[model samples]
Target: MYNVDDVVMYGTFGICKITAVEKRNFTGEEQEYFVLRHVNSDKNVFYVPTDNEAALSKLHSVCSKSDVDALISHMNSEKLIWIDNDAKRKEEYSRIIKEADYHEIIMLIKTLYLRRKELGAAGKKLRSSDENYLNLAENMLFEEFAYALDIERREVVDYIEKHIA
Candidate 1:
């Protein structure tokens, strides 16, 4: 259970700071929800049930700068797997994004990039769902990394571009 002011990853919502925790009446029963505000978009807020399985693990800044450095160092080498069917790929990518795992996000990004490159070489354009998934994955990862490093999302993007290249 997270307390007030705790930052947690909620599926695809990315890093959210717990602003409040209260019990509200729901269908003749009382349930607890965590009021969270997005770290990147301060205007966006979400109320999550305390026991949602989609709410995987909590991310804490236990790693030192060297660990972050190592993660960055390995960013480019991450492998991305491509699914043949668009619908199935979208569903799978959506679930993976919601899990909010850093390594998973890296895989998504790398996969998308490689897929795009392959399609480009074949004189084909990326599908709309592919574009959407790429954007979502990038935003989610950038937001979390920005919060963890105490930097802006743009800075995180710049750092990733530099390190991944």
Candidate 2:
């Protein structure tokens, strides 16, 4: 139930501004769609069905700076769980990324970051799958954080470090 010009977090697409809510008979039946324009990319646009609750469930309002701070603070006390099985770990990572929950995404990023550091200290490297999910989680979380906190994308890591250090 977002209105025009409302900014929302649309799953992995990151921050999107609702440009319009229009009814069109694209499938031979009149249906409403929320036209979203990606805030980070001018050429990217998305049309989400207005009545689809499952899809709409993924649309979350942009969090406030206080919310971001709270989430980061919470992360300091959260425990990291690492799955040893690659297949299961990948599936779990995919689910967390797809769900795009702020806390869960932070967990994924924190877990992978620690894992990467551990592997590096042992003279090893992250498995390709782990690396990919880490990057995806970081990108998604940072994008939302940047838009919400009014900071540049590149500054997210440093911001998090300063806040959580």
Candidate 3:
């Protein structure tokens, strides 16, 4: 059971702080739920079902320096080939973001960066959906790394820029 003030990851909700854990009467039975406030949003709270599988299995931290290193390494790999179908590509990217893997997030960031550069070279720009996915993946990875390293998220970005650029 998580205590109040514990930082945890929630499915699709990203990182949150467990502000409260209280027992309440649910249909005449005692039940416990976590009151979680999103780390990145203002005044956003979630009542997380204590028994929800995804919530229970949520990652508390990246923990391993190797994970961050691996992510950086993967980001430097050859860019992915652009998918011809926009809808399919968006779906695949969404799935990759939701998986919340550090390496996958890095790959997404790398792919989108390359895509943006290529588009710029061709006198084009990224579509709104592509921009959203890139921001989401970058934010997710940054938050996880910052939490794990007990550093500011901006610091993570700076570190990545300095080391991985």
Candidate 4:
């Protein structure tokens, strides 16, 4: 259970704060909902039912700077299992996104980055869908990384590069 002011990563919403937790009878029965506000926005808000298991699955604790450091170092040897079959690739990537695992998200980014470079050298490009996935993964990662490290989102690439170097 999260309390007010606690920062958390909520699925595709990226970093958010638990602004409030109130019990209401909106559905004709009293239930609790977690009121969240996006860290980057003041107007955007979300209400997540506290008792909803499926929705709660997407809520995750924010990672720390050390966690980010270790992850980047580990990424040096990790590889993305490229699925040649389009359907399988899409399905697998979709599952990873739904699962909202930063480790897998980083792997996805690495895989696509390498694949894009390989294709670019061959005078080819990734399928548009793969490109979109890359963008999505990067956004998710950058948001969390920026929040965790107290850096700007644009600096995430340079940070990772410095670590990779």
**Best-matching candidate per TM-score:** 4
Q: lDDT per residue, candidate 4, 1-165, as tens digits? A: 778899999998889999999997878999999999999998988888999999888898899999999999988788786899999999999888889787889889999999999999999999999998899889988999999999999999999999999
Question: Model 1: per-residue lDDT, tens digit, 5-121?
Answer: 877666556777889987877658787877888766889987666775554253332234455567789987787768998778988888787665668777888899788898999
Per residue, candidate 3 scores C-alpha lDDT tens digits across 30-62 of: 778888888878588877668766756654543
> What clash count does candidate 1 reach?
1
Per-candidate TM-score against the hidden true structure: 0.80, 0.94, 0.77, 0.95
Model 4 steric clash pairs: none
Ranking by TM-score: 4, 2, 1, 3
What is the alpha-carbon lDDT of model 3 when measured against the actual structure? 0.75
lDDT of each: 0.74, 0.90, 0.75, 0.91
Q: After superposition, how far is residue 122 of candidate 4 from its true place, in Å?
A: 1.6
Candidate 2, residues 1-165: lDDT per residue as tens digits? 789999999888889999999997878999999999999788998889999999898898999899999998888877786899988999999999888888888888889999999999999999999999999988888998998789999998899889998
RMSD to true structure for each model, in Å: 2.9, 1.3, 3.2, 1.2
Worst 10 residues of 3 by lDDT: 55-64
Clashes of 2: 0
Q: Candidate 3 regions off by >4 Å?
A: 1-5, 24-31, 39-42, 54-66, 78-81
Which ranking of candidates, highest lDDT first? Answer: 4, 2, 3, 1
Deviation of model 1 at 71, angstroms = 2.4
